[model samples]
Target: MARKPKLAVWKFSSCDGCQLSLLDCEDELLALAGNIEIANFLEASREVIKGPYDLSLVEGSITTPHDLKRIQEVRKISKFLVTIGACATAGGIQALRNFQSVSDFISIVYATPEYISTLEQSTAISSHVKVDFELHGCPINKEQLVEVISAFLFHRKPNIPAHSVCMECKLAGNVCILVSNGVACLGPVTHAGCGALCPSYNRGCFGCYGAKENTNTSSLSNKLYQLGVKNQDIQKLFRSYNAYTPAFLKESKAHD
Candidate 1:
């Protein structure tokens, strides 16, 4: 029989939650194992295998000098490289360092700042090498991960949408919590795929899916202000998980 396609999973500067989502796919994982060879995933199994991998899934951001070099090597070995989660695709929460001084942050967090060696800012994998696809979210949605992987394996296009969460809320028949309950939401500007999770629980969107394609965050911020969200609160909202993304950052700065 011909050898199965090899798959590799890699991590950089991240919380590991996105990679954990893959493990969370308990039943689907076994089916995936049957279709591909687990070549080099450090988070799951201990068995090491050489690569020239068919597909590589990367999590986390490039935050160190070594990480920059390592990602270049990973790209060379990977036929198709997909970045999973906010960290790999949009520089994660750690990327807040992009706005402030790294040394100042290190001093605040650690007793010995000199002992720590970190880049001034954390950046996404695309900054280092070419990424074939990106799965968004703080920890990506499991179903989306399955679809991206399955598409690669079967040579089909992934069905991931680049629309805003407003579409999702409408599809789920969720009452507009922003209008009905007077809650400020990022739903209009945030990417869909969390299945309107927060709104389903009567909470506003936190932009976990990152910025939607062609976002109009300025309009959303204006609506939020009109809904009585204080300017400081508006700033705080955009400064959450996906703060560093260009659209969110620009809006947050305007409010600030």
Candidate 2:
């Protein structure tokens, strides 16, 4: 009998929401296990086997020197590496510290700054090592996760889109919250994945998934200002889960 392909999951610095999304795929989990050997997923099982793994799904950002070194080792041992969620793809909410002094942050939270050992900035997995694919979102959409894994298993391209969230809203038949009510929305430039969630809830987009391909962030920012969104709020909007994403970061700096 042939051995099943080994699958591993790795973590760095994140809220673990993306990892939870895998578990949330309760019905699919058993089906996936039958197709691949589950190995080295600390979040799901205590049983860790030695690698080189067939595939690796990585969650979170690199915030410490140790994590930087560790991810390199993970990359060497994994045949295919996929980054999942905002932290792994765009440096997450913790990346807000990228704009502030790490020393000041540690001093404010810790009794002794000397006791802490951390990198100056939080950064995405791709900043440290090569990534085969990236799934964008704060928590991530579970169905998309399944699609990515299945596509890799079948040797096909994942159907994830690089289009704007506005396209998703249009497909869902959602009213244009921005045009209709003057809401400040990132839907014009945010990547499609979250299914236009905020607009459905009567709130503006927050860009939890980073910028879309060729995003016109400056144009969107100007429009947002015209919609009466305060400069500070606009900065805050870009400073959410994906603040360090180059497009969002550059636009936020332009506003400031």
Candidate 3:
């Protein structure tokens, strides 16, 4: 009999929403457990197994000196590492501080700034390690998470789309909020995973999944400006959830 592949999940500077997406899998996760060795997931179980692990799913960004060292060790132990959610793929909302002075931020957030030890910038897991694949979202869609894990178990590449959320909105039969009401939306540039959630409710996309492959944020920015979005607000929009992503970061810096 063949042994089940070992799986581990790790977290860093994040809200733990992405890890919860896994547990939220419920029955689907139970089905997955039948084929994989549930090795080291502290969120799901206290029992930990020794590595080198077959696959590791890393959540959150590297935001401290300790994070840098820990991720290196995780990289050394895992055969294949996948970064999940905005933090793991693009540094997350916390990356908002990458625009300002860390010292200033510490002084403002903590009474004793000297006691807090942290790096100046928050960054994605891929920035520090060779990532096999990235799953994007603030809190990732559970169906996509299952698909990624299933692909690994079966020895194949996951078929997650590289399309934009606009397509999803169209498919879901939601009236185009941008077209109908001149709303400022990141759907044209954001990666598709959330099923155009906000647009469904007449709200604009927040780019929770980060920039899509080959996105034209410049065009989107120009469009926003035409729709009467203020320049500073446009910059803020780009620098939201997946701000530290290269395309969005570069685009936002252009506004700055």
For candidate 1, the 10 contiguous residues with the lowest summed lDDT are: 239-248
lDDT score of model 3?
0.93
Give the clashing residue pairs of candidate 2, or none: none
- Quality of model 2 by C-alpha lDDT: 0.92
Write down the lDDT of every candidate, Cα atoms only.
Answer: 0.91, 0.92, 0.93
Q: How does candidate 2 fare on TM-score?
A: 0.98
List the candidates' TM-scores in order.
Answer: 0.97, 0.98, 0.97
Q: After TM-score superposition, what is the CA distance of residue 20 in candidate 3 from its true location, in Å?
A: 0.4
Predicted candidate 2 versus true structure: per-residue lDDT over 91-140, tens digit per residue: 99999998989998898999988989999999999998999999999989
Q: Assess the local accuracy of residue 72 in candidate 2 as a C-alpha lDDT between 0 and 100.
A: 97
Q: Is candidate 1 or candidate 3 better by lDDT?
A: 3
Query: In candidate 1, residue 224 scores what lDDT?
Result: 88
As a whole number from 0 to 100, the lDDT of residue 249 in candidate 2 is 95
Off by over 4 Å in 1: none
